[model samples]
Target: MEITLVEGDITAQRVDAIVNAANSSLLGGGGVDGAIHRKGGPAILEECRALRASRYRDGLPIGQAVATTGGNLPARWVIHTVGPVFSSGEDRSVLLRDCYANSLQVADVLAASSVAFPLISAGVYGWPVEDAVRQALTVLNAVDPAHVTEARLVLFGADTYTVAERVAAGFS
Candidate 1:
């Protein structure tokens, strides 16, 4: 697969799907979750509320992902995944990897040819930026790339873009 690195908003990407670094509630929260919900409009929230009322009444489990209509966003669908809250003393990297892996799986089910990803858990979740970037690259690099042709690391700022570019350079 080809991984494109971009320094911009994930919400603005024109792709098959975009991953939201959401909270377990699946309702709109801060950072990427808030942006996707706000820009994607009510359809996304409607599906999420229905999800809560039915399948996800207890909230989405960490490392699990679900898909919903992209609504007004450019993408055909939105894949929501809750990244584990970062703990300095605990190794929650597996949960972080699951966010990407599971999102890709959902995209495949949707027959999405491309997907864009934000740095899951690196924002309000308080993950160290460098480690977050490394983990993302590692997971994406190991994947078979049969389903999705393109996976983009949509960086929201220059600092993280620089960081991502550096870490990704170490990969392909």
Candidate 2:
């Protein structure tokens, strides 16, 4: 897949899919989750509520992903994945990778050629921004080229987007 890095509001990206850095509840909380819910409108929440009532009553599992309508947002669909809380005592890197991996899996299932992502877990979840960028780039770089034609790292600030650009450039 082709990985593009940009500092922008993910809600405005006119892509096929946009990944949500959701909490397990999937009901929408602060940071990226709240923005997506608020901008995407009630249709997104309605699907989330239904998902909770059926498949995800206990909440979405960390590292796993599911899809909902993007509603009023520019994208056609939202791939929601709960990222693990960063912890120093454990190797949560795998869970972090799964967040990106599973999101891509869902995107492919929808035949989405272009997808945009936020820096999952780097906000209130307390993941280091640089490391989060590295992980996102690494996982996205590893996907089968045919599975996704373009993957955009839709970062929110100059610092985060700069780091993502540097990491994407030097990371093998």
Candidate 3:
């Protein structure tokens, strides 16, 4: 797959699938999760509620992904994945990496050719931006998806984008 770093709103990205860095509740909290929910409209939430009532009664597990309609957003599907909170006492990097991997897996299952992702866990969840970039790139670089041809890491700010660009350079 072709991986790129984009400094912009993830919600604005025109792609087949957009990954949401969601809370376990899948109900929409803050940061990228809130943005996607608000912009995508009520259809997204309706699906989430159904998922909760049926399969995800206990809420989405960290690092696992599920799909919902993009609603008003440009993308056809929204892949929701819960990211692990950053912890200094224990290494949770595997969970973070799983978020990207599982999201891509879900996207491929949907036959999505392109995907856009936010830096999962880097905002309110307290993960450092640099490490988040590294984890995201690690999965995006290694995954050989059957349908996904492009993956864009959409950074919300210039500083975050710069960090992603620097980390992505090492992958080259």
Candidate number of the best lDDT: 3
In candidate 3, clashing pairs total 0
User: After best superposition, candidate 2 residue 70: deviation in angstroms?
Assistant: 0.6
Over 48-78, each residue of candidate 3 has an lDDT whose tens digit, in order, gives 9999999999999999999999999999999
The global C-alpha lDDT for each of the candidates, from Candidate 1 onward, is 0.92, 0.93, 0.95
lDDT of 3: 0.95
State TM-scores per candidate. Answer: 0.97, 0.97, 0.98
List, residue by residue over 17-92, the lDDT tens digit for candidate 2: 9999999999999999999999999999999999999999999999999999999998999999999899989889
Q: In model 3, what are the clashing residue pairs, if there are any?
A: none
Off by over 4 Å in 2: 145-147
Candidate number that wins on lDDT, 1 or 3 = 3
Ranking by lDDT: 3, 2, 1
Backbone atom clashes (below 3 Å) for every candidate: 0, 0, 0
